[model samples]
Target: MSIICKYTIFYLSKPLNITTSSEAMLNQVRSVHNVRPPRMKYPLWYLQRERAKDDQQLTEDNRAFVKEAVHDKFGMPAVIHGISTYDVRSALREKSVEYENVEWSPKFQRTGLIARKLGNYPMWLNNGKSVLTTLLHVIDNHVIKYIPPGEFDPPRKPYSCPNHKKNLGCLLVGAESADPQYFTKQYCGLFYKEGMMPKKHLGRFLISPEAALQPGTPLMASHFNPGDFIDVRGKTIDRGFQGVMKRHGFHGMPATHGVTKSHRRGGNVGHGGEKGRIFPGTKMPGHMGNRYRIHKGAEILRINHKFNIIWIKGVASPGETNSIVYLYDTLLPLRKYKSSPPFPTSKVVEDDQLIDSYSEKMYKFTNQTITYEEEK
Candidate 1:
């Protein structure tokens, strides 16, 4: 009877067209439960797959061909005889190339930058009032790739407004220098095409096709000017597995009275009749923080070109010290200016030009004491 029961159970659980061997059957069962097979070197498909036709294969013969292709694509005109890197750059700047002139529009959008939080400090205003400011250091930032709107296929629509078109170009930007040797072949290949180092962080920014910038173009702190407002976004510091009182800021039961052992406990989660169970999303003790947050309309207090740092007006910028944060122009209605922003991006001409750029209201630390004169 026991043997019959076991046979019936096995037959009922058997799937169609599977191998009859016990070992194969057991493996199939494990796979159904998403269990990793033993001795598997690569878990993801790309980690172990063969290279595609468009991708340059990692072979000696292919290396020279790939290099030649890259040279042809990005090579300067041979008409300029014997030009070095510096000479080419200088010559290009000296020569004025005809570009479709675009009028400045307040509605035009601009690119953004990724920066690291460099701590905060109090700064005295011109009015003698002190305010805390957060310093953001723009790291090594460069353009990686530009995909035109016609070629760029976004997974989902970014806006629901009927006036706006769904098609938008994408700019691949990277920041924070990193050694290529430490990254995977595919990961390193991304920066190789752009002639840049393997970046520590990479992000895609949607932009108009006209705002496209060629790969290898460098970005600097001057991308945002002082007095302009921006939005900073980053992951907040994580405080894992917190209680209701700490996470939700719930006041605990009174210390005295009949509170007893339930001082810190959340009393009476749900009622006893029709609605007995606790509802979903009810604030309870759970994982806290480590969520993406944005600080909008943060005024740019100053910019230091020497150190590539931007001092923002508020100390409430998301992320902890040394953590990455993204800065984009403010979208707030009152703060949003229709005036054209640095189209595409702001170009850093000479480092000396902006040793330290500050807003009019900001009081420079190096400046002398402030005094108010009585009106006659």
Candidate 2:
């Protein structure tokens, strides 16, 4: 055995003097193994702009000062439990400001709101048809900053038209005020100009220059009217590693048959001949959900100004309950707004007397029961 091992080592140690064509093939295999996947491109603004959480260490006094500053600006913190607190609500309520009157036009686009999906419920129409509706609560949303077309620069240009690059602007919106201590100093600094606390979520909206709003402007559910069609975008629920039956809805093999251990397995993914490898997008067991999806042209069935909640027509809005979603004007030509909407955002009315606004086709509980008349 020792003699055989010595002969094998000697033979393996010797270098092979192969032809140029064979050497080229070996080099090609090495190149294939060393090749790297291409990096994905993203917008400049998509890059992480804030430092890691708690990166800025502060003294006890400094932390207290920051909280106190926020309290002073937003008003005294409330201790009540069941009901919504007044302090935060009051802080979000900004005085209405008059800007140059700009008429709504087909070419103009406005900023979107960041709202939380409050779950779904069934609602009856005037015609007695039951429809499932999703409730979206618009949180304390405020405009943090606005970058004009000339000043706004993205890593990859979104438009091929030079005019579009010059005409479109970026709006930075923030929602759900959070404690300053939980966020880094750089993240908190973003709200400094608006005299607001750090937000739980931040979103960027692209709008025409004409629809640009001032920093600190409040966005409400009233921005969209009942009966208006809008688009919703949200992240779907993360359904981790799942089977073919659950992920792709594939029917499993018969349980009664003499199917060995391949009952739930996805059978035969590849071909026998030239197409030997499994094809991309072949349905198989893998990670599911947790994707950004858009549900377009959902009608606004109702709007509650008091709570800043809007009831969307369908329960098909992506994401699990309590997840944040973006609401924007629909881009569908047929469902697009025919009448004028608020130029920038709805005005912050001091007297929120109008609690609920319902669509014409919706059945209002306050109204009397429907009755049928005899044929004439």
Candidate 3:
């Protein structure tokens, strides 16, 4: 299918003003606001200014900003690996996330913290308070060095994740917003000694840099392609312990027709008198959530080629807004790309015409709800 645009939504930001004395035309001339772009004008602001009479159009800077965004062979919002550490202390305090650059290829997913699932309660809102994270331009993140799998002696200090080779891979990230003075020499020394840019946040991708990218390569939205099926795994919001009625979806006791205090309770949880101690795994309230969970097989919707921003399929993704999400190609057969993915690592390409030509279907959203209209 071809790319389709032009969906209009009205926003009530302020009162609109109309001039009675101003002369008007009979035929619609696609009048636009002089103060804002057509995409942001009436929906975000109150009044739409008349199209400028100067006829001076915006240069590349004004018409629409263009940045070469990443498109990929994978689905949208590519599966990014997430970390689960109760240790809030392990953070750089500035709050950052990580990733690795695939070689400048038209075959990779875009970058950043991606998206985190909030909950299963649905994210759409009438007040506009619940939109997913939007893309923000950050400085091109640089790779420090290719931390080979095996052990090696550095001229200065040892590297991060020194013990396990399998656990560590390539590190890719953006500019440092953290305080340099707060860091240790061992951390600081690792980068300066190797002639790599020091990073505030460090993330390791599963594969080799040579396969996906190179040392010192800059990762961008253009790194990832659209129409990907990503597997998002993250620590769900902790809800504490809950009962089987709530957690396991058990049918509780009858609430009517002579039912008394037993209502809403799991009646007869035990078997006989001798074996009366509530059996193991009996539906009872304990801990609810905050566990590591994965929402698999979500489709990538629209991608802003300029911002590397992605709109995924469902709102049921894993973490909260602004939370960090690791992205990569899916491992599951059902969700994996039907076409062969670029193996080993991706190659850097300048034109990205290959990306424009690849066959991909963006995700779609519908006004339908999940309902089981069946009775047992």
Candidate 4:
């Protein structure tokens, strides 16, 4: 890696202007761009400017005021519990289409749920193979509101297409229930109409019109079945102000014989002349991670109904432990389901009694040790 970087620097140092160039060999002399420190010809969103001096002071003062007020008046709101008037089971029964009648077409898209990442654990398969799996718990998820396709308007942004057509509605999903007394009146008002407690984390999922769920509808772990493939979306861990070596995996200048002071530097960005300015997408030292990303086609290994936890087949599922994530059906070409999924989400039957569900290859904790048949 170091050798490759050295060769690149050597190549970039060659003078683009051959006629006015020095007579001395190009390799012997270092170009000004090669020896000098790299500077940003362009700045990204976060690094454009510095905040005002009073901004930090104002934020700290506001935080203190809120803290003191809560202590003096509310004294930490208690966990309010109550039943919702909207009967979910009865509402489903009244629908014109029966459970079997509502078919899952290949074109149909499903709604997603917000889950909290609960770290990871190791599991052994029946074939003596061990696999690492991440635990994502669905934490008191409920549909707050649904905006139909005609009413939905995509956010106006430079990256977004201004003329893009809207074919799906948006479902406001929230997780990790919280009390309303601590929040502002405007914030609490959003949940008041839905008859729900304030949620710690809320996310919006764009789902087709046919998959639109009613407000106050509860979502559970069974929304996905064992062996199903899901897409996990979350913000990756924030790595602030990193160097080229750590951020871009670039091999720095060697740290020995004749090398001095330029050990960790990213040498040379350009050659002098027509193509003079540093390229826009050149990898350099800057902010790293903390971006929203989706890990597609992660297999669901197992699920526990009592705890509302699911074991998915990847340790690299984004987000730190206890952080919120959005789980949805995979839109990948080959991984998409051939048969029907849990259409319109799974129903909670009062008489049904299954504590745990596992995929065929998974080894259950409650089961006996594995034994293979003797060779013939």
Best candidate per TM-score, number? 2
The C-alpha TM-scores of every prediction are 0.71, 0.78, 0.48, 0.71
Model 3 deviation from native, Cα RMSD in Å: 27.6
Judge candidate 3 at residue 37 and give its lDDT: 31
The lDDT per prediction is 0.70, 0.78, 0.42, 0.73
Weakest lDDT window of 10 consecutive positions for candidate 1? 81-90
RMSD of 4: 14.0
lDDT of 3: 0.42
lDDT of 1 at 189: 72
Q: What is the total number of backbone clashes in candidate 3?
A: 36
How many clashes (backbone atoms < 3 Å, residues ≥3 apart in a chain or on different chains) does model 1 have?
Answer: 1
Better model by TM-score: candidate 2 vs candidate 4:
2
Question: What does candidate 4's lDDT look like per residue over 197-272, in tens digits?
Answer: 5566677888877877776677888999989999999999998989888888988999999999888878888778
Off by over 4 Å in 1: 1-101, 156-165
Instruction: Provide the RMSD of all predictions against the true structure, rounded to 1 decimal.
Output: 10.8, 8.2, 27.6, 14.0
Considering only N, C-alpha and C atoms within 3 Å, which residue pairs clash in candidate 1? 106-338
For model 4, what is the error of residue 242's alpha carbon versus the real structure, in angstroms, after optimal superposition? 0.3
Report the lDDT tens digits of candidate 1 across residue range 57-169.
57987776765654444443232111122111211121121223456566556667888899999988888889899999887677777776666656543345533444666
Please tell me which model should have the higher lDDT, number 2 or number 3.
2
